[model samples]
Target: MSKMIFVNLPVTDLGASTRFYEALGATRNPHFSNENAACMMLTDTIGVMILTHDYYRNFTQRPIADAKATSQMLLAVTVGERAEVDRVLEAASAKGGRADPNPAQDHGSMFSRSVEDPDGHVWEIFWMDPAAVPGDSSTVDA
Candidate 1:
């Protein structure tokens, strides 16, 4: 059996968040979806469960930090190529999401773009070429 990762997030609106995720090329897994939450399947191994604030609050006794004010985590996902990175981020931006709130970064072998969801969750879409990684460890700047 293979282990699957589920990224749970607190959203203000399930429907809107579902639309936002769908724009980013994720499909809702109806089998695990309900009025309180939507299961967005990005890949067979990776999935995101966007739950309403009330539903998510039940999982933690600590106060939920407003994502817009404080960034708790940055969700980074790699795509196949540089073009794909742009495709996903573009769709996110078109659907009432934001793009690159921070400075854009491009390290020759890797390119990364960021987007902020309606709830202010940061998603970083990046592409990397394994062969491009510097191999001489000793020579690398410490």
Candidate 2:
């Protein structure tokens, strides 16, 4: 079986968060969804679990930090080409998200940009060329 990555984020409204993610091209996963939480699939191997504040507290003993004021974590999605980065960022913005207040890195090898969700969770969309990647001689082209 293949391994999967599940990212759990705290949200005030599970349905609203689900709608936001759905607008960004993610689909809901019924296998792990409920009234208090929604599982959103980013890819076959990556998924995000949007949990309501009340439900999220049940998973962790630590305090849930206010994402708007201070980010608890940042999620990054990588694409195969630079154009994809812009496409994703644009889609995110169209869905009520905002562009991250940072410059994009165009190092001729790798490119990256970020966006902030309504809840202030940062999502960085990037593209890296394996052939042009630095310090990675172990990688080979087909």
Candidate 3:
């Protein structure tokens, strides 16, 4: 079987979070969804599980960091072209997300931008010209 990834996030408003993800082109999967959690499918292999704060707490003992005020992990997604990255940021912004929370990155071959969801979870959208990568590629790590 192929590997799949499901990034679980704690959300204050399940409805708003679900809608925000829809704006980014994800569809809710009813099979894994309920009143306290919504499973949004970004792709066949990538999914996002947005759970209510109460429900999320059931899985973790640590305090939930206020994503708006504190730094946590950053999530990223790659698109096929540079224009797609811009389109995603615009969509996210239109759906109450903060566009470009971080500085944009343009390395000729790789272009990236960031957006923060209403809960302050940062999502980086990027595109890269695969051919521009060196044969060794390890030298380009950043």
* Per-residue alpha-carbon lDDT of candidate 2 for residues 10-117, written as tens digits (9 for 90 to 100): 898777678778766679989889999999999998998989999999999999888778865677887778898888888888776788645777878778898777
Worst 10 residues of 2 by lDDT: 133-142
Q: Is candidate 1 or candidate 2 better by TM-score?
A: 1
Q: Per-residue error at 26 for model 1, in Å? A: 1.4
Better of 2 and 3 by lDDT: 3
| Steric clash pairs (candidate 1) | none
CA lDDT of every candidate = 0.87, 0.82, 0.92
RMSD, one per candidate, in order: 4.0, 3.5, 2.5
TM-score, cand. 3:
0.91
TM-score of every model versus the real structure = 0.89, 0.84, 0.91
| TM-score: the better of candidates 1 and 3 | 3
Report residue 19 deviation for candidate 1 (angstroms): 1.1
Ranking by lDDT: 3, 1, 2
Report RMSD for candidate 1.
Answer: 4.0
Q: Which stretches of candidate 3 lie over 4 Å from their true place?
A: 134-142
Best by lDDT: 3
